[model samples]
Target chain A: MIEVNDLTKYYGQKRAISNVSFKVKKGEILGMLGPNAAGKTTAMRILTCYMPPTAGSATVGGYDIFDQSMQVRRITGYLPENPPLYTELTVKDYLMFVAKIKGVEKDKTKAEIDTVIEKASIGEVRNRVIGKLSKGFKQRVGLAQCLLNNPQVVILDEPTVGLDPKQIIEIRELIKNLKGDHTVILSSHILPEVEQTCERVVIISEGEVVAEDTPENLTARMKGGERVLLELEGDEKQVKEVFRTFPDVTAVKVNKTAGGLLKVEVESKKDLRKDYAQALIVKKIGLLEMQSDKVTLEDIFLHLTTKEEAA
Target chain B: MRKTLAIFEKEFKSFFYSPLAYVIIAIFTLITGYLFYNLLSWFVEQSFMMTMQAQQYRQAPPKFNVNLHLIRGYFGTLAFISLFILPTITMRLFAEEKKQGTLELLYTTPITELQVVTGKYLAGLALYIVLLIPTMFFMALLFIYGDPEFLPVLSGYIGLILLGSTFIALGLFISTLTENQIIAAIGGFALSLLLWIIGWGATFTGGTLKPVLEYLSILVHFEDFAQGVIDSTHVAYYLIFTIFGLYLSLKSIESVKWRT
Candidate 1:
């Protein structure tokens, strides 16, 4: 539902984003993973028709952002980093005003508001002033505002930035439920949050797209195929040699821990924990701890972003 | 038009919800009420003096126009008070949105800049009109007690509304230039006061310079309407001035979008 090509934006002499491009398919939840200042907000701003890109162009719902901005804005709902709210107004009044501006029909304004209020689960606080509400409620009210007009595209910029863990989980669930109905572009620095909620992830770093794929594919495609950790009472060199000689073992590293135990990290294409545990016993190397873990999005993100910085 | 009305409705209702609007209206009514009372006393004292002189000289009292003596002075004071009060009203128009980050919501909406500016301008103008309400009660007192030429008083109000529009439009433009409400209020007040008094330079200069200064002065156009004259030149001046201010506001909004 959205296509961005070489979108660049410069605030005066400082370039906020440069030649950044990405796409979101219809009814897909695409997560934009990036640290702060990674041009995520800037890209979303350009897509929402909040501001025009300095170079190149974008189209939303098959309408060009520059020439058909009204159409783009009409169909796209945006929630900026800070929830745009009037502190003095009640939640219902605020939603009613937004509906009028968003062009909800006069006859349906109240029903449309009721639907959003129910969706964001803010019905309990519907009559309460927004400023007096809790942060979680305020964030949900922001989300409720986006659901107005039933826009085909919903773009949220760091929707769960400062929320507590429970609120984050609730928000993630709400976003996950938006699948197959509304095209969502969510930007966040939290990798696990993206991994859990998004169908596809776009890893952005230094104003560039480093990787774009499913979370599973991203973790699997990075350098580490499989990883095994072993804490043992043995010579570091002997432990490394054994894992190096093991079938499908690609690389191994050993370091001494505080407890006088050798910590061995073995990266291989295949799992050999059962075989390796037996071999260690036969070699008379005492095993204190043995654990195997799959590569996570955190590992891939760090590797991709840090590698880009190094180059 | 519907979008503009939506913005206007929200803004207009917000003014009543805040204490600043009530304070401004209270202070404005008190000052104008005091001036009207004092003017009424002066008019009565002057007429009493005229009657004494006529009776002593055995002659009829000459004509004394209440519209000139009372209504004109009341309208002038209203115009002056609005210059100060309107800035505070307009100060919060765009500055508050910018300060609270609601400008992002406005920009992303499908509404155009013209609609936004027009809606805000109308809201401020409406409040300025509301500020004139108490004084209207004062004007009604004059009609109940004595005969005053109604057309002159009517023209004076038209002039006051026009002048208020000029102040509000200029102040609205200033609000768009900053996120700080204090700065917007102070900047708008200073610029408006400067324009109101810019014609004073006519006293120091001669030839073509004097006319230019007088023509540029916002107060000069309103002075004609305050005195009961409805000259088309003065009407054109105020219309042009208001449009120019609104034009600047629209241009500034556009420039902000393109402020790369």
Candidate 2:
């Protein structure tokens, strides 16, 4: 439900984001992956109508961000990187104030506040002053304010940054559940978190989109076919000699495990597990375990960002 | 309008929740009250001396009513003093929020920048009026101890309130122009004091330039209301000043999002 075209933002002489463009479909969970100063927050701010782009335009729910900002704001909810909260106000009061400003009806504001409090699972600490709450609760209160108006699009920047492991899981599951009801665009440096929560991933670096695809597709793209992990009991020199003789084993990395078991990461041009196993058996090098090491999202993120920097 | 009112209510209530508003009001009232008492005592002593001199010389003395003149002088002095105090009250309204990042959430809502500026201005005005409450008892003392002209005293207070509101608007505008609260407060104080000093320059110019300078001087217009005249021109001037200041605040906030 959001379309961004040639979006560029400059701070004085420095270009924060240059010629960035992307689209997020309705009901899709799109993750923006980037390092610090990668223009992720800038792009999200432009989409939420909190800031205007220096160049080009964006449309949310069919309304231009600059021209019809009020309409765009009506349908979009934003949680900034720092979780823009008023420390002096209580969580309940803060959410109530957000609901009022978000233009929820006066009669429905209380009910909406309760709904969001429950959704963010912050009902117990609702009356506590926000400044005194723990970081996880503070983050939840920020998320709760964003959900107050029931906007069509919810944009969260580093939503799980300061949370504990348990809170992180809960927040991820909550975001995953918001997929169909609200188009979610979240930015994060944590690659696996995005891989688990988002249906599509867009990796940005140096103010440009480096890669975009589903997590599976991006990992596959990075892998370029097949890879494998193997453990063999043999002398280091003998393991290297046997690996060199094996056909289609493109790359081999050997590690010595406990009790001198040799663990090796073997790259290949195709699936050759059966052939490799036979080669090890005939050579009398005991094959203990063998499995494919699938390329992960972290590997894809690191590879793409590092490659972009190198280029 | 409903959303704007909601913002106004919350902002107004927040002043009570924090110690900043209470401290500012208490300090303002204490200083103003002390100044009021000292000024009244001086006026009364001057009047008695003039009356005694008239009896000694066997001539009609000047009709020196201490309470009436003190009320007029009270408002005139308030106009000058509010220059420094109102800025302290309003300097943090927008600047502190921008500094701490809460402005982002407010901007992302469906409300217009005008509504946000107006809401903040209203909140500042409400606190200012509350701060003026203690000064009213000084007037009660005026009524009991001397012959105080009721309408003139009321008009002078109206002038003080209007003048204070105008400064709050100017301070709010300056606050929106920066993220540093101290810088905002300093900028606001400088601008309002400059406006207050504009009256002194009117005396330096001669001929036709004098009237033009006088018309621009806030003190020139405010003096009429402070003396209980209730001049329509002065009333219009304060109202227009408030609107102009609020307009600039709105533009400042809008430019922030536009330039982002």
Candidate 3:
């Protein structure tokens, strides 16, 4: 439901984001994965029509953000990094105010607010002043404001950043439930959160898109080779020599751990578990344990974001 | 227009929700009441002195226009008092939104910048009118005890509203430039004071320069309204001044979208 092309934003001479491009399919939950200062918020602001892009174009729900910003704003709900809440207003009042400005029908404004309040699970604190509420409740109110008018696209920036672990999970669940009905573009630096919640992720680094794919596909592409860790009772030198002799073995390192155990790490072009077992049997070495190292989403993110800096 | 009213309703309600609004209104009433009482007592004393002189001379005292001494004098002090009061009313209009980051919510809505500015400006003007409500009772006191011309009193109120609108528009424009409400208040006060006294420059110069400076002084046009003279030129001047202030505010708010 959102399309961005060559989106660039400059605050004075400093480039906040440069030539960024991405798209979110209808009803798809897209995660923008980036570290701090990666231009995620800037890109989201442009899409929400909070600010126009300096040198590119974006359209939301088929309305150009620059020319048809009113139509775009009508269909899009944005929760800025700070939540954009009035501390003096109570939760219900704030949401009702948002609903009004979002142009909800007057007859249905209260019902719409109640629906979002229930969705964000902030019903208990609905009457309390926002300034007095806890951070989690306040964040929920922010989410509640975004869901008003049943917006087609919800753009949230780091919705779970300052929450506790349990609150984080609750927020992630809330976002997950939004899928298949609302087009969500959430930005975060947390890899596992995105991996668990988003169907697709656009990995941004230093104001550029370094990678974009599903979590599994990204991990698969970065897996590169098979790696295994083995614990064996043998001479460390002998263990290294045995693993290195295999033609498929690209590299091998053996270290002697405490309790007279030799720890061996091996990287190979292909799975060498069979070859290692045969070699251990011929050498009469006791194989205590063996397991392959599976590449994780964290590893993939680090590889993609850090590799750009190193280059 | 509906979006503008939504904004206006929220803004107007926000004023009542905060203690600052009540404090400002109370302080305004006390100050204006005290000034009115003092002006009335002084006028009574002057008239008493004139009657004593006439008795001693065995002749009639000169006629004293009650409207000129009491009603016009009270309005003059009120105009001065508003220099301090109006800034407090407008200091938080746009500045608080910027400080609290709520401007993001405002800008992202389907409303134009003009609508937002106009909505806020009207809210401030409405509150100023509400603040002036108590002064009507003070005026009613004049009608019961003395005969004051109705036209001048009505014209003076119109002037006060126009003057308040002008100050509010300027304050709104200044508020958009800063996130600090205190700075906005102080900046607004400084600008209003400058505009209030610009006519003083007319005394130091002659010919073209004097009229140009006089034309810019808000107090100069306000005098015509205070005297029961319904000059269309003065009305047009205040309207144009208000329009100019709103235009500046609109431009400043729009610039924030680009610069931020």
Candidate 4:
């Protein structure tokens, strides 16, 4: 639903984002991962037509960012890092105002406001002034404003920052529920939030996209040969000698425990766990525990960003 | 126009919700009431004394004329009040939006900068009219006491409204230049005071410089307006000034990237 071509932005002498281009299809939940000052916010601003690109072009729903900004704006709902809220306004009034500005018809405005309030789960605080509400409530109100017009593309920047664990979970679930109706592009430094919520991942660093793939593919790409942590009831030397009999075993580290247990870290060129266990069974070496070490989302994110920086 | 009205309603509601609007209105009313009471009492005393002195001299008791002076004095007082009040009201229009990070919300919407500026300007002017209502009571009192010509007083109010609107426009433009509200208020007041002094400064200059200086003077245009004279040139000047200020504000808002 959105196409960007070599979009770049510069602030005076400093380049915030350079040579960035990506496309998001309809019914896709895209996650943007980046470190601090990674130009993620800058890119989102350009996409939402909040700022012009210093070079290149971007279009939302086929309308150019520079030329057809209003058309682009009509279809996009952006929630910036700090929710732009008039604290004096009550939640209901704020949503109503947003609905009007987004050009909702007067007849439908009230019903739409109520729908967003329910969608964001801000029904309780609808009558409360925003300034008096808690940070979590304020964030929900921000999300509600974005959802007011039921825009086709919903862009949320750091949607879960400064929230308690429960509130974070609630927001993540809310985003997940918006899957088919609206295309979602959410940016966050928090790895798991994006990993859990988004269908596709775009890892960015130093104003560049380093990796873009599904979360599973990204983890699988980083996963090379199989590795397993084995704790065995035997001497380290005997465990090492028995492990050597396994053909696919590539590397091993043996640690002897005080209680007659051997902890062996085994790396294999292929799936060798069954073969190693049979060898241990024949050698009478007790296999206490064997857990495969799979890389977590955090590791994938760090590896992608830090590897790009190192390169 | 619907979008403009939506913006206007929001801005107008913002005044009552925030203490700044109420404080400005209350303070303005109090000060205007004080000035009005003192001015009319002063004029009554002057006219009474002038008549008594003429009777003793056996001359036709000097025909007391508070007509022209009353209207002129009201405009003078309004100009001074506007010098301080308009900036406080306008300094927060856009500058506060930037500071509070709400400008991004407005900018990313499907509205143009023209709609935003015009809506805000109209909201401010609406409040100004609310404050002007009490002064009309001062006019009513004058009518009850003496033979007061309604046309000049009506003309004087129109001039005051235009004068206040021009100041508001200038203040709104300054407000967009920076996120600092204090700087906006100070800059707006200083520019207005300079425009007010230009007419008198023209008298100080010799031959060639005088007319050129007078043409730039807001006071020169206001004088004709205050005298019940609806000169098209003077009306055009204030109209152009207002439009020019609004245009500058639009440009300033456009230059800044709205980042939240």
Instruction: Please count the clashing residue pairs in each candidate, in the order shown.
Output: 0, 0, 0, 0
Candidate with the greatest lDDT versus the true structure: 3
Model 2 chain A weakest lDDT span, ten residues long: A240-249
lDDT of 1 by residue, B55-172 (tens): 9999988788898887888788888888888899899999998988888888887889899999999999999989998998999899999899888888988998998888889999
Considering every candidate listed, which one attains the maximal DockQ?
Answer: 1
Interface root mean square deviation per prediction: 1.0, 1.4, 1.3, 3.0
lDDT against the true structure, per candidate, is: 0.90, 0.87, 0.91, 0.88
Model 1 stretches with alpha carbons more than 4 Å out = A234-247, B57-59
Task: Determine which window of 10 residues in candidate 3 chain A has minimal summed lDDT.
Answer: A235-244
Docking class of 4: medium
Question: Model 3, range A1-311, lDDT digits (tens) per residue?
Answer: 89999999999888888999988999999999988999999999999989899999989999999999999999998899898898888888888888878889999998999899999999999999999999999899999999899899999999998999999999999999999889999999998999999999999999999988998899889888899999999877778778878888988878888899988889998888989999997998889999999888888888888899999
TM-score of each: 0.96, 0.93, 0.95, 0.94
Better of 1 and 2 by lDDT: 1
Model 4: per-residue Cα lDDT over A27-51, one tens digit each:
7999999998999999999999988
Clash list (residue pairs), candidate 4: none
Candidate 2 wrongly placed segments (more than 4 Å)? A230-233, A254-263, A274-278, A286-291, B47-63, B207-209
Provide the lowest-lDDT 10-residue window in model 1 chain A: A219-228
TM-score of chain A of each: 0.96, 0.95, 0.95, 0.92
